[model samples]
Structures are given as C-alpha cells and as structure tokens.
Target: MEELVLYGTLAAAGASGPRNPQKMKSGQQNHNNSSIVVCDLHSGTPYQTFKNVSLPRGSTLQAVHATSDRVFSVQHNSSVLLVYHWGRDSAVQTIVLPEKLAVVKVSPSGNWLIGGAQTGRIYIWEVMSGNLVAVREKHYQEVTVIEFGRDDDSFVFTGSKDSTVLGWRLYDLVNSGECQPVYSWNKVHSLEITGVRLGYGLRNVYTSSLDNTLRCWDLERNELVSTYILPEKIKAIAMDPSERAVYAGLINGDIIIVNRYKLNPTTGMVEGPKGNNEKVTLTYQDNSDILLTRPDSDTKASVTCLDISFDGTVLAAGYSDGQAYTWDITTKQVLRKLAPQKEAVSSIQIVSRSRKVIPGGIKLTGNNSNMLAKKKNDTSAEIFKLPIFKRILDEKEIENHNVWVKLADAPKQEVDDLAQVKVKMAKFLHEPRFIASAKVSKSNVAALTGRVKELEAQLQRAKDLKQAKEMM
Candidate 1:
C-alpha cells in the first residue's frame, strides 16, 4: 500500500476562550501558532512542518487546503492568506484580504481559489492571473464550510451559520459574472452547518450540523434523501470515496460510522438503514457496531475535523485538544495517534504522497539552498512571476486581456477530387432544379446509349456489304 500523509492545522491557544471557558479565559489575546504539521498516516510521526512568521497572532479554523505544489491557509479572525511551497519552511507569499475568512478552499484543478468570509461574502480568485473574479454575499450568517465537488471543480457547495447550503457553478462566477447560486437548500438543517461533502459525480451531498443531525441531499432532484439524527451535536463529517459509509465526528469525542447500505436478511440485496427518523444514539456498552470512542474517553474534547483517505481505508480525525488520530475503517480501531499540538487541531487532511512533487517531476526535499541560489542568480525570471491578487474585479482589464491557445497541427490526409465532387453532388440532389437536371441527364444518357448501339449495328452492316462486294 502506498503511504499516505496527513496535513493538520492547530488553532490558536486563546482563540476559543469565549466558546469554551475551561480552555482559556475570555478576552485573552489569541496566540498564533501558524504552522502546519505533515505526518505519516500509518506511523503517526511528523516529518515536515510549514510555518509563516509574518502571520498575525490568531487562529486558523478549517481553512487549510493543499495542492500538488503548494498549501493554502487562512488566518482566522484576520484578513490574511498564506501560500507556502512544499519545499519551503516559510510561506512563499502572504495575501492580505479585505475581510476575515472563516474557510478557504482550492478548486480541484488548482486554477481557482475561493474563500468564505465572516460577513457571508464569498470571494474567488483565478490562480494564474491572480484576478478577483467574483465577490458575492448570499448567506445571512458567517460561512462555515466551502467544498468543491469530488473530482469536479466546476461546482462548489457552501454551508453557512444560517443553516443554509447553496451550490454555485464556477463558470458562472468566472465568465458570466453571475454570482447567483445554481441551487439553494435552506430548510434542511435547523442549526448551523459544520461540514459539507459531495458524493461521486456530484450527484449527492452530505452535510452535518450542530443540530445533532446528518442529512443527505440528492442534487439531481433537489430534495432531501435521508437524515440521520445522532445523540450528540455533530461537529465534523467525512464521506468515503465510494460513498458506502459516512463518518460523523461528535462533540463528545465519539466518531459515528453510518453505513449507507446494509444487506437485507430476506433478499440479501443492499438497502439503506431502515427505521423511523433514522435515530442513531451512541452508548458505551456492547454496541460497537457504529461507535468509535476516543482513547481518552474521560476527557471531553470535541472532534473538530475529519478526513478519509482516497482509498477509503483510513480515517484521520482531529480534536479540539490538538490531538489527531488515524483509524482503520475496516476494523474500526485506532491505527495511530499523532502527537498533540499546543492547542486545538482545527483541520486535518489525508493526501497521497504523489501530490508533494513539483511540476517537473522534482520531489521537494525541503531544502531551500537551491531555491535561494537560483533566485539570487536570476533576477529576470522574477518578471514572469504570478501577479498579486486585486481586491476588486476590473472590467477594463478583463476586456483588454488576451487568451492564447496553442493548437497542434492535425495529421495530413490525402484528398480525392472525385470523391469531393460526388459529395457536393449528393448534397445538391435534394434541390428542385438539381432533381430536374438529374432526370434530364439520365434521359440523355439513355438516348446516347441507344444511338451508340444503332451506330454499331450500321458499322457491322457496312462490313458485311464490303465482304459481299469483294466476293462478287
């Protein structure tokens, strides 16, 4: 099996003081721990860390996303975005935003970056051009989660504290300048949504809320498919790649695995879980079928984030206590426990190792010596660097922008002039004038054939006459 890595972010120590009084006193200055831990998922040992020295002293909630070559993170309670290269320990670039973002997500193609702000406004930026394409506000409360569809970057789903989930088409935002959402579901959850995940082909969506319920929505029909009511408030949720199971992280340090399909006893066919309201209550007793408790059960730490591997065999869970755990999906047991951070673990992601490679098949060795030397030697190359993001969309710049497309030469093919003529003739056959002309040509051909036959007969008679004259 290929080794998987986990990227985790820790919240500021005093950021959650108002929410949890036991952690810290209210009105305390939030301490910044602007670092991301990259660890081996199987062994739970960290090998690399990325830090930003210039970020303000604050927290980072679930605002971390990584691409093939870079990691994007936002400074919670501040209007700062940090972009880091995999090989660099420090951030490569720091972007200052106009407003504080609650969550940020990168599109699957890495061509677009979007952030949901505390004011319920969503901003999108084109990665290569660094142009702000769209900035729209539709939610009434703070945006909590932003998720692009699985393997599909054209569609985005956003959940807010107003208990509404809206889906937007990326093309409309970028090209048409229409910031309206394609679909909006407002009455599904009564409380604020915490997590949002899309199913395969973007057909279904799964969301968890603080209302103690996990709801599934069918995007094709725009209707609610199923709702599972849990005992505790659901804080985080992750779905497997195959969509066979859903893992919900609760506030009480418990993880609930709800199987979407179960075998029927009579027909042996896979069917959904059957019950009125789908009420699933967690207990400490012998019902180990769906519950996975934290190792330190005595301590009540909320599960802040959850992510599953691409293969769906491993699950990574992050807690408010700054601890991270890896679990085996088949056995429902803890595979490894990572070292705790100084504060709460705000976000966790399970990604493959291949994503760490740079564009030129060069794996990042975490050595900045070569980069420093290259930068010092080549000042002209800096001119081609990506432009800084603009705060507002520039209509004049867009009108003057030019797009260049490199088209490959098509393969050479031999052309038949007679075939071309025949095709042209075939196309005109349906015309009235052509039809009449075709009939005239056919009659003329028949008359010419008859004339040729008559001439041949006359020629034979002449030969016979010449033979007779010669005999006489």
Candidate 2:
C-alpha cells in the first residue's frame, strides 16, 4: 500500500502538495452539509386525509391557481379565489371573481384580471382599480378555461365544454359583438370539452376532450389542425412554449406528451406505447416525452388539471383528489407539491416569472429596525390563541434560550462562532433585551450574513413544508 501510494503520489503531485484541498474565498465560505428548500411552487410533499367516498375516494381535492406571488388551490364555487400562503399556514385574499366566476386570469402584464363564469358571462376588472370595467356574458355553457396570450394582451382565448373555442380582441372588446368563433368542433369530445390551449407560436388552438382525442384548431381558417387519440379519456392539456410538443394528462393515470414530429414525409402523426409505466424521450426539446404514473399504492387516479411553465422547467399535475404536484421537467424530479385542494382543481395556472432581488443596496442596521420592534411583543395576548398554554410557552421559551446559549459554548471554530452569533441573535429574537446591540456590524459581516441566511432558509423551508401539509 505504501509503495503504491508513493508511486501514484509522486507521479500525480508533481508541483503542488499531495492534498487537493479546496480553497476558501474571503467571504464565500460555507458549511459542508447539504440542505434543501422545498417550494410550494414545485414538488414538495403534502400531508392529507379524507373521508371515504368511492373507488377514487382520496383524490377529489384538486383546485390549483398560479400567480406572481403564489401557487394556489382554485375554487369551484363563487366563494373566492384562494391564495395559499406557505408562510402563514393559511390563505390570503379569497378574491371574489367577477360575475359567477367560472374562470379567472391575471393578464401576462399582471395588471388586469378577467373572470368568466356560467351561461357565457365575462368580466374584465383592473386590479389597480379593484373594479370591473366591462362585463360580457357571451358563452353558452359557463366559461370552462381561459388562456392569456404571450408578448401582448391584444387577444385572449377561451374554451367551453360547450364544444367551442373563441378568440376575443382585447383592443376591440367594446365594439366586438357576438364574439367571433376562432374554431368550433363538437366532434373533438363527446362527453365535455375538457381542455383547450393555443399552441406556442402556431396561431392554432389545441383542444382536449372527455372523449379522449386532442385536436388542434386553426381559428383563422375555422378548421381542425390535427387530432391525436389517447389511450383513455382526457383530463388536462398543456403545450410547451416551444410549440413542438403537447402533453395531455389523462384520466388513465398517464401523462401523454405528443411531439408534432412527423415520422414520415407525408405522415404528421406521432405515436408511442401507452400504459401506466414511466417513460421519457428526447424529441421536441430536452424534456420532450414523459409519462407519469402513481407508484404502487392502494389508490389510483387520473390527473384532473395540469400545467407546465413556459420554459418547460416546471410541470405541475393536479389530481382528482385536492392535491397538486410540481415536477422538474428535465430531470423528471418532483420539487414541491403544493398543498392539496379540498376539491378537484377545476383549473391550474403557473406564474413563470420569479427572481431574486439583486442585493438591492447597502443594508443599514440600527436600533430602530424591525428586528428590535418584534422583541417587544411578548404578551400572552399577542403570542397565544387559546388561553391555556400562553404563560407556559413564555416561561419555557425564556429558559430554553438560556439553556441553548450555555450548550452552544465551545472552543471549536464553528462552535465558538455559532455561540457568539447565538447570543447576539438572541438579543434580536421574538423577545429580548437591548435589541439594539444585536444589530449586525460590518466586521465579519459576510460570515454572519451567510450564517443568518442559512438559518432563515432552513427555517423557511421547514415552515413551507408544514404549511403545505395542512393546506392539503
């Protein structure tokens, strides 16, 4: 062993030392431990329970909505749009949809909102005005779905189980009467118009049906572009932004992605084996073909409503049960499962634009900061909901803090660094004394900032997961 090590080390270590240690940047040091951040936006697991119904008992809870700040559970009733908050363990703003509120959408510009409900009704409301500007009840069977066009708000499309697809001019809405039918096909589905979507860049509308066929519609010429049949009835349809492929989530526990890829010169039809098995293919793009199936379980289901982000990075599926799953399209990995809905998601939309603020500016720490103010609210009235355990928590938390400080005291670099930060941070906690002293100082600021960020991220992730479970 020594001879072998000597030979290899001499041959490889030529100039530098034998140990290939990683260098620590001045302010970029980090812990060796790995951590995960589960977002309600993607594939985090949720905890759920239900009263038995029938064979598909646990799966009926599926309402999903995606907006700029939140991914949510949709409302079937005229009640209110649910904005699920991963941090609050509850929902915010149960938005009342205009009219009877069948379908709702925040425009691509994030300025206007449109709500379409039963009996061919539509309402356009400006969020800033918090008031409805116009109402058009033009449909025949309750607006079933709504899709906002990209790049411009010039036009939007709607599909109804009434077996019709309509494209309305956003600019000429007032003068536009008897809304023009971009495309209409009653033969697309016999049961109910399940889903309709415009293909990316194709100017053609795609429609899916309870009858199990996905048909493309050319609104301008009023024609059916093409039709592809699935193994079973259809539940959801999503077209990737590239327009080369489309995914039809089925009632057969299968996600069938069809590529507009033609196998032969004259044949435009593309086909693959159908089953509850897992499959992935590379055709339309990197994440072209994918098949989703429930694992070995007592429950089986068909996805009710599903959506994929524009870039095809995030894919979400809402089940008949009040549940939603977000998937990493390329890796075929589940990222975070939004909490399950109490009922099946009538629809689901994803907000594609998300960003991290570019370190806005210099952060000024001082005594008057919010960190100091939160320390003052240490009352049973403020801390507890029920009267029984309020005092007990205050006393226990106080003791716990002292115990933690003592336990963390040590001579090791990490331990010492942590202990010092702990004491300072304790002074800035929910209840503390001399909160001003806890303000961050520039000295060793990077280390402290990284540590604080790490802790906050970990805590936020845990909080998001817990909320997701309760929401389910």
Candidate 3:
C-alpha cells in the first residue's frame, strides 16, 4: 500500500499577484522555480518533478487535478492547460482554452474534463475524442469551484462568485442542442462560494462561502438541509469518506471538524442533527466542534486547500505559508510537515500508487544478463500519451461522434456460411478416408432397401396361400 502526494505553489515570495497578465506572460522567460512536485507521503522527499518550458511560473488556486495516468494544471492568467504523464518530465500536451480557467476537474471515470473559466463560463470536453462538448455562460462572476459527484459521475456541481450553485447532468450538456441545469440554487450565500462537496448518493451537497457559512442542500428535494455558521470566513472544506464528519478550514488558520450525527439518549440510536434557519452557530468557545491548529501559534497562514485520504484516517492541508501538513484524524496529531515551496501552496492531492505484479518473484543472483536480455527483448510496453485537445469544436466532428449502447442479452445463433460449407464438403470428398467411409455407407443403404423389398414379396405370397386354403 503506497501513496504519493502532489502539490504546486502559487508564486515565489514577494512576487506579484498571479492575476497579473504581464507577469504571467514573462514567466517563461524569467528564471522562476515553478514546478509540480510529487513526493512520498511517509517521507517528505520528492521523487518526481514536472517542469518544462511551457508551464507557467504561477498556478491558480486549486487548479490542479490528477487522474490515474495523467496530471492536469491550469496556467495562471493564461488560457493554457498543461497535461503531463506519470514518468514524463515535460508536458505531453498543452491544451489551449478559449479563456483562462479558475479551476478544472476530471471526471471520476476519466472520460470527461470540465473547467470553470474566469468569465464565469463552463467548458466541458471529451477526454478521448478531444471534442468541446459544451461552452456555456451561466454565472455572472468568476467561477470558483467545479466538482463531479463521486457516486454518480454524470452529475456535476459548480459554484461561482455570483453566490450560486448549479447541478447539471453531463449527458444533457453533451447531447442536447441547448442545455440547462437540472437544479439551480441562487442567492443562497451573500458572498462568493469557496468550496463544494457532494455527500453519499449525491443527495446531499455541502458548500462553503466567504460569508462565514457552511450550508448543506438536499438535491432531491431542492431545499436547504442544514447550515453551520462559523466566526470567520471559510476558505476550504472537505469531508471524510463516510460523510460522518465535515472539515472546514478558516482564514485564521484554524480547522474545524463538525459531526453530522448526534446520539439520542432516549432512543439509543444515532440521528442526524435537526436543521434550522438560526439554530446552529459554531464559535471558538464551543466544545461541540474540534479545532486543529498549527504547531507554531505565531504563524496565522490561512489554509488554501484541503483533501482527505481515501481511507478517511488522514487529512492533508495546504496553507498560504507554502507548507503542507498531514494530520491523523483520530489522534488529531500532525503526521508530517512539508514546506518545500517558497510561495503559497495552491493544490494538494493524495493518490494510491499503481504497481505491476510479475507471476513469480525474480531471483537476485549474480547473473544479471538474463534480466537485461528480457528487458531488451520486451516490445509490448506501451507509452501512454495524452490526447491533444481541439481548441474549437467542429460540427463535422460532432456529427461523426460515435454513440455507445449496451446491447441486451439475446439467443446466440451461428452465422450462415454457404460458401464455407461447400468448401468443407469439397475437402471432405477429396480426402481418401472420407471417400471410403461414404462409399461404405451408400452400399449399406442400397442392400437394406433390396432386403426390405424381398420381405414384402414373401408376405404377399403367404397371404395368397392362406386364401386358397380357406376356399378348399
């Protein structure tokens, strides 16, 4: 069981803001220490680094995502999306977008890629076909967050600075000529939305806003489920795998953990906390919520990003101070402290490693010639390449897109092949053994027909003799 953590920085300390277009354009020429680092979780040593001439000196906040085989990141203040493979040092493909994207997310199945642009427009693309499926402007301001439902990949949830969250079905966006959201919730928060998370079955959606509130909505009912008010602005949010607890990162460098269920003494069963418009307000003095702080109290760097491990036992957090920390959930202790970047940590991801297993363990003998020969002789290894995305969608390409359908089970039938049957018969006649067997069968059938005819004649004569005896 091995895991790797990938993280990138915003910009070097004392550098200009990432939104400066002039600075971003000159990033490639300048000698900036900008790279995506992949390191081991247990040990803080970086094992792989993705650096190339095409990557920007600064990356936008939460603009990075990793799939099983590729890594995706957006360039700050630019319309470029850098894609890198696992073992490649440079970007394999640089996707040119119509506008600069604030955030991007790859679908769980790795078939679709969706991004929210600075102009509040959403762009969706087919990963394999390189087709721009949809480009729509729905938000009034810059799009901040984009997420796909874990249980249902076709369901997408997006939030923006307009203080709205919209739910969409992927199929509708791709197939329909004019697409609309399945559900839209507007004016839920007074300020811009910062983070969004979907609960089990995609029925419950949790969102955090700068208005110092964490609101949960019931997608099925299209209503607000619960709201947790915090003292300070919420910068980032994450949930455990079980959805039993929610974690909110504050601007004051405090991580608050809230439990969704409470124990009922009378019933002796756990029940969800009742929702009210003005009931729940979490404060620093409240003992109901747990607070996690950095070791150094003087450092008040806000948490920029947060991600929980697959097992829900560890929490990875990145901060404005360019540090990433892994915390043990149960013990509430820091497992590792990694601060390799000089700028703010914008993204963090924890992914399991993929390994290839051999049928039997290789022997470690002194003779290494066999291993070298096997490696030289192996030609089945394939180099994984990222598909080059088309900037503009072509009508012809869309019309030619292949549609997939699942065929139902039916009775199987052999194909009729008259020519093949004739060829087989000709071969059978040409064979000496088959010809002898055929002759024997033909002679046996003729003899049996003659014998039957003789038996019929004998029966007729016996009947005549019986009739003569009767007359006498």
Give the residue spans of candidate 3 off by over 4 A: 13-31, 52-61, 264-269, 276-278, 286-289, 356-381, 402-472
Q: What is the lDDT of candidate 3?
A: 0.74
Residues 1-472, candidate 3: write the lDDT tens digits: 5677888777454433244333332113223555678877767676677773222232234588887677888765467777766666665455667777888899988888898888889888887677787887788888888888876687998889889988888898777378889889787798888888987688788889999999888787887878899889998899988889899989898899977887899999999967554347888885633888888758989988888888888888888887888888998888888755766778888877674322122111222211211123343332333344656767787778743322333656665798779879899889999877667576888999999999999999999999999999
Kindly report which residue pairs in candidate 3 clash with one another: none
TM-scores for every candidate against the unseen true structure:
0.73, 0.53, 0.75
Off by over 4 Å in 1: 1-4, 10-31, 53-61, 176-178, 273-286, 355-385, 402-472
lDDT of 2 by residue, 77-187 (tens): 233444332222233233434333455566667556666666667666544334444566556776677776766676777766576666777655423245553434544
Candidate 2's C-alpha runs over 4 A off are 1-64, 70-99, 174-189, 265-290, 326-347, 353-472
Among these predictions, the greatest TM-score belongs to 3
Q: Best to worst by lDDT, what's the order?
A: 3, 1, 2
| Ten contiguous residues with the weakest lDDT in model 2 | 1-10
